[model samples]
Target: MGKKCNAPPECVPDYSKDEAYLKTVIPTRIALFESIKGQQLPHRQSISGNPIKYSSFTIPLNYSGMIILRNGSVKDGKKWISTPLDIAKGISKDWGENALISKVNGVLWDMLRPLEGDCEPKLFKFDSDEGRDTFWHSSAHILGQALEIEYGCKLCIGPCTTRGEGFYYDAFYGDLGLNEDHFKQIASGAAKAVGEKQPFDRIEVTRGQALEMFSENKFKIEIINELPDDKTITVYRCGPLVDLCRGPHIPNTSFVKAFACLKASSAYWRGNRERESLQRVYGISYPDQKSLKDYIARLEEAKKYDHRELGKTQELFFFHPLSPGSCVFLPHGARIYNKLVEFIRNQYWKRGYQEIEKQEFGLKPMNCPGHCLIFDHRVRSYRELPLRLADFGVLHRNEASGALSGLTRVRRFQQDDAHIFCREAQIKDEVKNALEFISSTYEIFGFTFDLKLSMRPDKYLGDLETWEKAEADLTEALNEFKKPWEINEGDGAFHGPKIDISVSDALNRKFQCGTLQLDFQLPSRFNLAYSAEDEAKKERPVMIHRAILGSVERMLAILLEHYKGKWPFWLSPRQAIVCPVSEKSEPYALQVKDQIHEAGFYVDVDTSDRKIQKKIREAQLAQYNYILVVGEKETEAGTVSVRVRDTRDLRDESIEGLLKFFRDEVAAFR
Candidate 1:
C-alpha cells in the first residue's frame, strides 16, 4: 500500500487533549465541498493541493416518461430527475417508508439514485437480500464515520461480506493499537452518527476534485488513480465523513437501529502480504434490535455446529499454515470424504454415467476441457447421443488468499463433476432428469432446495440466438420440473445459461452446491461433431455441465454442520462398533466386527477396559450409527445385542440378520 496518511491537523479531534495538531492550528483546505462542486468548467486547473481537472460529464434529466412497475402499475417520471424511491411512494405509503432498495428494470438500483430511463421497478424491504445488503452496507459507512471521527483512521475499503450477513471495513490506523477495549469509543461515535440522521448525499466529482479532497489520504488516492478516465467518480457524505464509493446505500444513517462491533483483526492491505498491514474491523447491523438479537443467538447456536470445531473433535480434518486453503483429511475425515464420493458414484452408476479421470495438482481449474477432448476423440453416429461422463478428480484454481475460508472456499478440491453431451431436442428431458437426480440426492440428505435459471450475461461467448435458445431450454426444463424458480437475470456463465440450485440445511442456511449449466461454446470451440441420423451431415452436440455435490470438501463441511455430526448410517465413518461386555466376550466381539466389516460396512471392535455401558455411551458420543454389545448369552446364541445411535431402541439379532440389515441400509442409501 501507499504510505498511510498520518493524523493531519484537520483529522485531529476537536474534543481530545491528546491531539498534538488541531483544526485551529491547521491551514484551511482549498475550499468546502459545497462551494466547488457546482463549478462546471471543462478543465479547471486552479486548485491549491493539486492541479484540478474537470470533465463535462452530466446526466440528462430532460426525458419525461412513464415507469412501469413490476405489478403493471405505471408512474410518470422524468429521467435523471425521478428515482426508485419516488416511484415507490406512488405505489404505496408502506413501500415508500420501508423500501431499502429497488430494482429498476431488473438491475439493483439504489432507492435514492435517479432512474436513467423509463423502467419497471421492484422495491425490496429489509427481508430481501438486496435490502439487507444495502442496510449492512449503509451501516458500514456509518462505522467508517465512527472510525474517522474517533480514531482519525484512513479508511481503505468497506464492503458487505460474501457470506450471508454483515460488513467490515479495512482502515489504516497508523501506530494506534486497536482491540476490544477500543470498541466502546467506536460504538459511541457510531451512535452519534446514527443519531444525526444524516442524509447519504451522493455527487459526481471531477478527478481533480477527488484528488484535492482526498489529498491527505494516499490510500484513497491510490484507488482514485486506478479508475478509467471516463468512469464516474462518486462520493457519499454521511455526517462529517465523506467517502468514495460505488454506492446504492440506504437513504440515511438512522436505518441502523441496532449495531455492534464484532471484532478487530490485522490484515495486509488488499490481501497482499507484501503490502502494509491494516486493521480490519467487522460489524453487523439491523433495522431493529430483535433481528440483531436473533442474529447473535444464531451465532451462538452455530458454534455448536461449526464444521471446523466438529472436524477437530471428530478427527475429521486439519489444516496447516504451510498449505493455506488446503485441508488434510485424517482417517476419519477420509472416510467421510470417500463415503460422499462413493455415494455420488453409486448415483452415477444408476444414472448411466461413465467415470472419467484426469491429472490434478493445480494443472486445471475443472474437468471440462479434458472431457471435451474425450467427446471429440472420434467421429460417432447419433446412436450414442447423450454421452455422460463423471469425474471425482481433484481440481485446483488460484483463489485469492483473503477469499479462502475453511472448506467452503478452497484452492484445492474435488467435485462429483460430470458433463452430458446430448442433442438440443433432448435438453428438457436431460435437464428434468438432472433435477430428479438432484431432488433424490438432496432428499436423502434432508435438504430443501431453491432453483434459479440464470440468463445470458452481457458479455457472452456465443451468438444471441444460441443464448436465447439455451435460456429457453433451461426455462422450459425448470417449468416442467414443477419447482418454483426465479429468474436470475444476467447471472449466467459466459459460456451459457444455467440452473443454479441452492440447498437449505438444518439451520435454514442456504448453500449453492448443485447446478446444471448448459454450454454451447465448449463443444463448438472443441469442434466436436457426430453423424446425424441421415448419415450425411455432422451435428454438434450440446454440452451440459452437471454437478450435484459441487465441491466434495465443501459438501463435507456442509454435511458436517447440517447433520451436526450425526452422519447417516451409510455415510457415517463410525457405522458400527462391537463392544465386548467382558474380557471373555472379546473374541466374540472381534468375530462380530469381522463379520460386519466383511459385509462391506465400516465396523470396529471395542476391546477397551471401560464397562459396556460406558463403551456404548462413548460410541454414541462419537456418533456411531450402531452399537453392538456381546455377552455370554449373546455369545452362546451367536447373536449380538444392538442399539441404534441416539435412540432407546435395542434388540438382539443373529449375525446373519445383522449383515442382512446392513445390506438393506446400503441398498436404500440410508
Candidate 2:
C-alpha cells in the first residue's frame, strides 16, 4: 500500500519537533573561497599598450579555463576578459605547429577580437570537429580574397559544403566571364594569399553601413536589403579586400597552405532558378603540401573511374540530349545492372524477406508507401514480429537539370530499398541487423563509411512525445552497436529519426549510400497494425525504413571511379580478351574463347587482321582484366600465355587451369 501525499512543509520534519531528522535532511553549501583555495588564475599581458584584464577567480590551473565575456564590462561579475588572439595563440602553442585557429560566432576573426559583452566561447584544438569546419570555412574566405585581388570579381557568397573535395563559392563577375581556363590563375592567386598570412579582420557594422560599403555590388545590396534594420552585419577583411560575411575564419591565411580551383559552373543566385545566374567556382584547399599532393593524385585516380568516361570506353551506357536525365544502358551496362539486382535479391531471399513489386508512378519519392501497402495486405500476429520486405524498384524525382551531374545526382535510378515492420521491443535488434548488413556490403566493395544520426526537422509530423520516443529508440540502437556517429541536428526525415551512412570511395570522396530510419508515424498514417498475443487487441507495429545502396546508377558510378574502370574480376564488363600471335594461331584462340564462353567467362577473341602487338595494345586500352596470347609454341603445349592488366608479367598456364583461376577470382567477388 502507498502512503498518502502531503504538502511541502508537512512532508518535511519540523526542526523543533524532530531535531535529529532536521540534521539528516539538510546539507550546508561549501564556501566559494574555500572551494577554490589552491587554484590559480590565468596570467594576463598587455597588447599594443592596451592593458587587458583577466579573471581573478581561482580556477583549476592544471586544466585550462577560459574567461567568457557574458556582459559588456570586466566589472560585471558575468564578464570574463579573454581575447580571441590569446585563445588562438594558446591553442596553437599547446597543440603544436599543425594546430589550426578557428574563429567562432561568424568571425574567423583575428586571434585578437576582444571579448565583448557576455558570450559563450569554446577553444578548438587541431582534432576538434568544430575546428576543422572553421578551418575550412576560413580557407574559403582566403580563396575569396585571392579572387578579388586577381580577378576583381564581385563576391556574392562563399560557404563550406560537404560536397566535391572541400569548399566552393558563387561569385558574380560583372562582364568578366570566368571558365575553366581561369582555374590556374585563381589557384595561383589563392596560393599568394596563403603566403601573405593575412589575418581575417572581423567587424560588426550597421545595416546602413553594409549597404553603403557594398553599394557597387548588386548581389550584396540585394542581400543587405533583406536584412532587418536592427541587424548587425559582420564583415571579414583580408589584405586589400573587404566583403560582408559572417565567419569564424582561421587565425590567419598562412594556415591555408594549399588550394586549387577544380572547375567552374553557373549557379543561380540563392539556388533559385528564377534569380540571375552567377558563375560558381569549385575548389578544394588543404592544410599542408602533402595533403594537396594526395588530393591531386586522388583526382587523377578518380578520372580513371569517371562513369561517363567508362561508359564511352566500355560502350556500357550513354546520355543523349533528347532525354537529358534518362540514361541508355548499352548491352554491357544492362548486364551489370541485372547482375547487381540479382545479387541483392539473393540476399533478400536468404534473409526471409518477401520480394515485392509495385507500381512505379504515383509512388512517393520514398519507398515507404509501397512497403506500407504490403504491410496492410496481411493481418500480422505478434509471433511474426519482424517482417522484412525488399524491393529493387525504379524511382524518379523531379531534379533540376542544373542539379544533375555525372552519376551523383540523377532523375531515374533503382533503389536497393527495404522496410522492416517490427514490434516496439524489437526495434533495437532490427536496426542493428540492418547496420551490420550495410557495413558488410560496403566492406565487400572496399569502402570505409561513417555513420550519422539525424534528428527531427523544424517541421515534423508527430508530437513531441512521439518524436522523443523515436529518437530514444534510435539512440539506444546506435549505442548498442557502439558505432561512432555524428549528429545532423534538425535534418531527419519528415516523420522520424534516421541513420545515414556516408562511404568514401577510392578518391576519398564520401557518398551517402545507406540509411536506416525509425518511423512510427508512417505505420499510423497507413493504419497498419498487428494482432497481439491476447487475441483481441491490435497494436501499430513500428516501421524501420532502410536502403543499403541508395541508387544503382550512383553506386555504379562510385564503383567505376573507385576502381578506375579496372573493376574486380566478377564486375568487369570485359573480363578476358584473347589475342593470337598471328593468323596461324587465330583458330586456336577462337577455340579457346568458345570453351571459355561456355564456362561463363566474358571472353573475346581478337580476330581482326592486325599485328599481335596492336591487338594487345587495344586490349590494354579496353582495360580487360586478362589478356591471353596464343601462338605456335602455346598451341603445341595446349597452353596460353596470360598477361594481367596493368602489368607486363606473363605466365604460362593450361586452358583448364586458367579457366579455374578466373572462376575462383569471380567467385571471391561474389
Best by lDDT: 1
Q: What value does the lDDT take at residue 491 in candidate 2? A: 78
Candidate 1, after superposition: displacement of residue 171 in Å? 2.7
Q: Compose the digit string of candidate 2's lDDT tens values, residues 1-670.
A: 0222244445632333444422331111112211222131222222233333433311112223334432232231112245554543443455334445433342333344556433333455434444566677777787776666566555788877775347777876544557888887788878788788887766666677666566556788788888866666777676655667776676778877778887888888888887666788877777777887898897787776678887788888887888777778988888677777777787788777888865666535667788898879978898987999888877788788998876668877788989999998888888888888888788878999887789888778878997888788888888888767756667799888899888988777888888898888889989999899997999999999888877988888888878777778787778899999988998899999999999987889998999988999999998888999999999889999999988999999999999899888976783
**Shift of residue 102 alpha carbon in model 1, Å:** 1.4
**After superposition on all CA atoms, what RMSD does each candidate show versus the true structure?**
7.5, 17.2
Error of 1 at 652 (Å): 3.4
Residue 267, model 2: lDDT of: 87
User: After aligning candidate 1 to the native by TM-score, how far in Å is the CA of 326 from where it should be?
Assistant: 4.1
Ten consecutive residues with minimal summed lDDT in candidate 1? Answer: 53-62
lDDT score for candidate 1 against the true structure: 0.82
